[model samples]
Target: MEQIIANGLYLGAQYALIALGLTLIFSLMNVLNFAHGQMYVFGGFVTYTVVVQLGLPFVVGLFASALALAVMGAAIEKFLFAPVVRRSKRDESTMLLAAGVAFFLDAVILLFFGEKQRGVPKVVNGVFNWDMRIIMPYDRILIGVLAVLLIVAFIVFMNYSRSGRAMRALAQDRTAAQLMGVDVSRYSMLGFALGAMLAGLVGGLLVTITGVNLGMGGPTSIKAFLMIMIGGAGVISGAIAGGFILGMMESVGLTVLSAYGDITYLAIFASLMVFLAVRPQGLMGKPWG
Candidate 1:
């Protein structure tokens, strides 16, 4: 039971990290990036390629993965999506554009990395036990700590920094922000890049505990999509809250109802159904005035 709780908390934190990036993208840009999970996988690949393949320091790969994705995100926004947004008559086209990119990227991943799962070398190893009852591994502890610190840092950035303020302003009211001299194109690109960087960092980090493979992007993207839906599409707080909630649900469901292992999805689906029926706006989505 104790281990279950610990695992659930860690999973919740990790999910929240991914959800945070996803929600930020939606909040900053009206486009829903269906290709985010690939970026996540790419991040791990970058780490694996660097640290494992090239024999560099793990930390270098850790940050390099983020930088690589950040650049890719900016390029995607600038060249791919922005061009479509400029000429298109509707925002709906963005979805198709994103979907197209996702499929293309997925194919690219398969071609380059193949279907094999690659394990990340542990950043740190060993386990810790508390009074012979509660036990925690160092790797899990590292993940949880890093996730929390990163999340806190992100929140601080969004709240206190100048660029962060600009993001918040845009998320709140794009027209007003633009009218006040905010550069829409620059910040929009930055928002997308930052979101991708977050996902990539998680990619590198997750590999410390789990193996990375090509198909990871799809399930991860699904969970993120579900997370934001539960939290409300454009609400950052909603994403965080929803992530933790789903994490606990998955943990408890798997632990207690192992026989009905599908309980995680079943519970999520049931909640989604109820939310759609009663309050489709999401837990933290603001009701329009």
Candidate 2:
């Protein structure tokens, strides 16, 4: 039972990290970046290279991956995405643009890596046993701890930091924030860069916990999409709630229906559909003002 709980927490933490950035970006920019998951895959691959090929420590690999993706994200926002935003006739254009980016990045990764799973060395080896039973990997526990810390840090930064307040202001009213002389473009760039950093950090952690594969992007993206939808379309709290909810559901589903793990999503979505029918605005999300 303890092991099951631990597994659920671990999975929830992973989902939280995956969905957090998307939550922030969508809330702040109203841009649903479809390539978010691909950015994560890119981070995993970069982390693997930094650790395995460059003989760097895992910490260095993580930092390098985050930094690299932050720059890439900012560049994409500035060069590729901003232009489209300026000229787009409908909001869906950004979604399609993001899809194009996702496909392009996936193709590039496939061309180079050839669809092979890349293994990452454990940040920590061995398992810690509590009392007689309840065994779990130290690395996984460490990763979970970091994920929680990051989540908290993000919340704090958003609430207390100057830049954080600016972001919130922008999310609440873009035109008003712009009128107030907030650096609109800079914050958008900052938002993308920071969101990409979180995604990259999660990716590196994933590499440490599981392994990297080309196909990871699609599933991660789907999970992220459902998380936002379940939580609330643009609510960070909703994303967090939805992630843990989905994680626990998957954990229990795997335990009970071991052979039909995928059924968990069906159950989750069914529940979500029912909830949306009743509340339409999501768990933490407010109806539009």
Measured by lDDT, the strongest candidate is: 1
Give the candidate number with the greatest TM-score.
Answer: 1
The C-alpha lDDT values of all candidates are 0.87, 0.86
- List the lowest-lDDT window of 10 residues for candidate 1: 280-289
TM-score of 1: 0.96
TM-score of each: 0.96, 0.95
Tens-digit lDDT string for candidate 1 (193-250): 9999999999988887896899999888998988888788778788888788788878
For model 2, residues 8-104, the per-residue Cα lDDT tens digits are 8889998988888888888777888788888899899989999998899999999998998899889988998788988988877898888998999
Off by over 4 Å in 2: 259-262
What candidate 1 gets wrong by more than 4 Å, as runs, is none
Q: RMSD of candidate 2 to the true fold?
A: 1.6
Q: What clash pairs does model 1 have? A: none
lDDT of 2: 0.86
